[model samples]
Target: MAVRLPILLFRMGLGPAFGKRLLLLHHTGRATGLDRRVVLEVVAYEPNAGSWIVASGFGTRSDWYRNLRVEPKTVVQFGNRHHAVTARFLAADDGADIMARYGRRHPRTARRLCAFMKLPSDGSEASFRDAGRAIPFVRLDEARPRLP
Candidate 1:
């Protein structure tokens, strides 16, 4: 499928082609218990905390989103580097804040993301907030190795 093209690229070690804007999420299927992969647009990258925030444009129905909810500990690929991470489901308020910031930083891309999700946005902060409230965001924080 056309949608799986990114996944294939990631598999081929061409993930660097997508740069920092896109990351490959490797999670386990909640029902099937099989490995699954999805490429999601990075809504925000927190360098200080080594976390990557992403939104579920399809809402809670997205398999990857739900998968992470069940198994917070997973791995993600940014370019060719893979890191163990823990998923943190953000609250609606946090989503609103991130969405607002994202809109301000990348207006055109934000509008396109909203449009793709069929959310009406006039490029106003309020509209972005509304869209954020409707969408679910997850922060993937890098997992720290446990000391023995």
Candidate 2:
């Protein structure tokens, strides 16, 4: 976890500059009532459709995802802007398809996905394919922006 701290801080700070693609997600612990925010790489957005898609590269092991399992509603922040969003956890089948598409568009992310999922990076398509299945994909429906 300590090794990941610097990377996490870097992502949290420069996320927006990377693109409109990175978003900061806030989730509240159902039991502890603690507010937690995580930086996620946003791979796709459908403005016309009014939705955005994100992937949990950390798979089901991520704390934020666990919090969401208990509390589906969350807050999202992107490029200095913030919104109250509802999280819809896509079914495993749908998540797999979305992750495949995401990997196709962002090959670099696919590599990171493999590492995050604890898959062997033998540089094989099969490894990547398996890694994709382990990650979790989510869609966010954001409401109007508001100050956090």
Candidate 3:
């Protein structure tokens, strides 16, 4: 119930209030073909690429991660702004780099995230990189319209 609070806020058009740190993901159930929504933390935002990087704290076992693998096309709402996007799984190397940098920027949050994911973190670059390699990171890139 507490986890759904953010989704409710998003539905109330207050999601953007959280800025780029959090987003509401509108996805589909692969097997049920049903619309579903989840709020995820945005680890990194690439302004140039118009993409947001997020990680599955529960690794590949996460249902949202599984659903995204099957249907990458989806919608992401960063507060008031919504975009048509596709989910791209980042490589382990990229994850390592991102995690290392993220730890540098937000040491406490990074450590907390690692703990939540059941990954040990010593607040060191190598530890963060190792944790990254173990987790599943996804990039939600703004999808370009197909030429008709």
Per-candidate Cα lDDT values, in order, are 0.93, 0.71, 0.91
Quick one: best TM-score, which candidate?
Answer: 3
The residue ranges of model 1 lying beyond 4 angstroms of the native Cα positions read: 145-148
How do the residues 1-148 of candidate 3 rate in per-residue lDDT, one tens digit apiece? 9979999999998986898799998889999999999999999998677889999998998889999999999999887888899999999999999999999999999999999988999999999999988889999999863343
Top candidate when judged by lDDT against the true structure: 1
In candidate 3, residue 99 scores what lDDT? 98
- Give lDDT tens digits, candidate 1, residues 1-148: 9999999999999999998899999999999999999999999997667899999988999999999989999999999999999999999999999999999999999999899999999999999999888789999998863333
Question: What are the per-model numbers of colliding residue pairs?
Answer: 0, 0, 2
Q: What CA RMSD would you report for each candidate?
A: 2.8, 4.6, 2.9
Q: Please report how far candidate 2 places residue 66 from its true position, in Å.
A: 1.0
lDDT of 1: 0.93
Candidate 3 lDDT (Cα, 0 to 1):
0.91
At residue 52, what lDDT does model 2 achieve? 75
Better of 2 and 3 by TM-score: 3
Lowest-sum lDDT 10-residue window in model 1: 139-148
